[model samples]
Target: MTESPRPSEGRSGGAQPAADLARIVVFAAFTAVLGTFPGIYLAGAAVPIVLQNTGPLLAGSLLGARRGAASVLLLLVLVALGLPLLSGGRGGIAPFFGPSGGFLVGWIASALVVGLIVSAARRPTLAVLLPANLAGIAVDYLFGVPFMAQAIGDLRAAGVASLGYLPGDLAKIVLVSLVAAAVHRAFPNSLPRRKAAAKA
Candidate 1:
């Protein structure tokens, strides 16, 4: 009879525990660092348009579901601990209570969702990339818009202000898709793979 493999065999067989920790830390730090890029503050908007989303997008596509979400969560914890880790060095508990709070909340969740979709895709074609990125963004707005509206006491205003993210987000979608596709092809093992559909 064939013997079953040990606990750490198969899927994560060759993975080092330290490497896993490092991947988490590195991605978290990378996201925080990217947040430092200067953002464009609109004339009358409370939040600025930033490329901060890039980090999470890359993390999700590269790291897979659980790891991606973990990375984002770690960064958020640091920010909550008063580190100036967000765009324009905005961090701490204050941001979590502001109009942008919901979007922030959505980050971790969206990363998980995006990672699942990205990693599970057989190939990173437009069919997969376009939907994955847009869906992730929609999830962010799902949580973001409501909080924004409540904070400002006007859903209309919040909806209007959110339009500012469109162009930038669309750009991000394109860029991330291209990068992810290339990386996925070159290093197929870098991210998780699509699971086979269960047979009847």
Candidate 2:
């Protein structure tokens, strides 16, 4: 007679999709919660420095590429639906057309890059996560600067103005790296496994 598959094996396959869905929902909600924190506006600056940016960094570092990007996209979809899900209760298609629009759009790419970098490692450590998070921040600024330049009618000034975000962003990188590293330590499987190289 054929034997039944082990209970553990049966459960593992079924549980994976549920776990993935749960993580996606949790991170998306986590980002929305971060937006509840008031944003900091720099002197004479149109855009505010917001903690919500960290959500992508954390999501990518913890969830890996596909799920991380999905989380950010989910939040953006809600925002597009006119939910006050952004910092200071801002939302809708308006924010997407505003000075901060590029940054918002860049978040998906930033998370994708961060996840790709971190997942390359066998284990996510502080050193690996730090650079991964920094790269994500760079992606964000890349998109944000040009949009701000266009909005303000001053490319040079927009570049300079973005400098104000450095201090806070650096702090976030450190914080996220530490947190991600700790989480990975506690749960080794939290990050995605690196793909094996194909045979020639």
Candidate 3:
């Protein structure tokens, strides 16, 4: 079996890994910054609605699958270490074991899926980008619901509880689609090189 080339083995190879690493760190920090903004915590909701997910979306759209997922994983690791990186400065092992744990696990997969879509398409416009982002959102719920169900002890009820997040997630999809598409179009070089075509 052939191994994939290392980042250092590619064109402009020496700096490729560093570049990818930088992008990953930057986006992880971006998500952390988003979390610093206020969140809406519903009385019955297990997790607060925050802008943190948007960071993963942008990282995926611009950085491709691997780096995008890495960015999420990085942020999660920090949270696990009790860095207080989450929205409202909330983070720690406690959150992971709480109702929000599943969603936390979902972030990595969500970013991978979103980046794969953009990479597969070769050209991502708002029309296509929004749906891809929506799919990522769905991926998040898939991971979240089961964990929530386990915590709540009612599978059906967990699904019902997650509904409150739909509206906010939908808004994020729209906002991310616009911003990602614009970034691809206006400053294509800013995005990771695998996907997201440069504006002609």
Candidate 4:
């Protein structure tokens, strides 16, 4: 007779989906909560500096690519649905077309890049996470700058204006790297299993 699956195996398998769902939901809510802190608008730039940007960084580091993107998407969906889930109590389709819109959309790609890099690492150390998170921010800027330029009709000006975000973004990189590294060290299993395997 064929052997039946072990009880422990069954339990772990059954619980994994639920655990993933819970994590996704929680991260979505966490991102929304970050928006509660008001955004700071620069002297002349339309895009504001906001802590909500860090949400994608942290989610990606902790959840890996697919789940990380899912978490960001969840929050965006709420914002799209007219929920006041964005900084400055802004939400709905309007934000998606505003100057900050590209950056908001970039959050998904940012999470994907960060999670992919982190997942490739054997261990999520600060060394690995710092660059990974920085790459994620670069991806955000790639999408954002062009869109902002389009909106304002000045590519050079948009690029220069985006420089204002550097100091805040750098601080976020350090904070996310430290926090992600600690969490990975304390809970190794938190890393997604499928992508954790390093290719030869």
Which candidate achieves the best TM-score against the true structure? 3
Cα-based lDDT at residue 38, candidate 4: 77
Deviation of model 3 at 95, angstroms: 1.0
Model 2 agreement with the true structure over 20-93: per-residue lDDT tens digits: 67777899899999999878776766767788999999999988877788889888998999999988898899
Top candidate on lDDT is 4
Worst 10 residues of 2 by lDDT: 1-10
Tens digits of per-residue lDDT for model 3, 1-200: 01122544223212456676777788889999999887777665666778887888887887777778888998999899999998878888988998859988998999899988986775788877898899888999999999999998999889888887888899899999999999898876654554223322
For each candidate in turn, the TM-score is 0.82, 0.83, 0.85, 0.84
Clash pairs detected, candidate 3:
none
- Please identify model 4 stretches exceeding 4 Å from their true place: 1-15, 38-49, 194-200
Error of 4 at 121 (Å): 0.7
Better of 3 and 4 by lDDT: 4
Model 1 collision count:
0
Question: TM-score for model 4?
Answer: 0.84
| Residues 1-200 of candidate 1: C-alpha lDDT, one tens digit per residue | 01122343235312455555677789989998888887777676666768788777777878776677778888888899999999888888999999889999898888888888876776666678778877788888998999999999999999988888877788888888788778777886656433342221
> How high a TM-score does candidate 2 get?
0.83
Q: What is the Cα root-mean-square deviation between model 1 and the actual structure?
A: 6.1
Per-residue lDDT for 187 in model 1? Answer: 82
Q: What is candidate 3's CA lDDT for residue 172? A: 91
Better of 1 and 2 by lDDT: 2
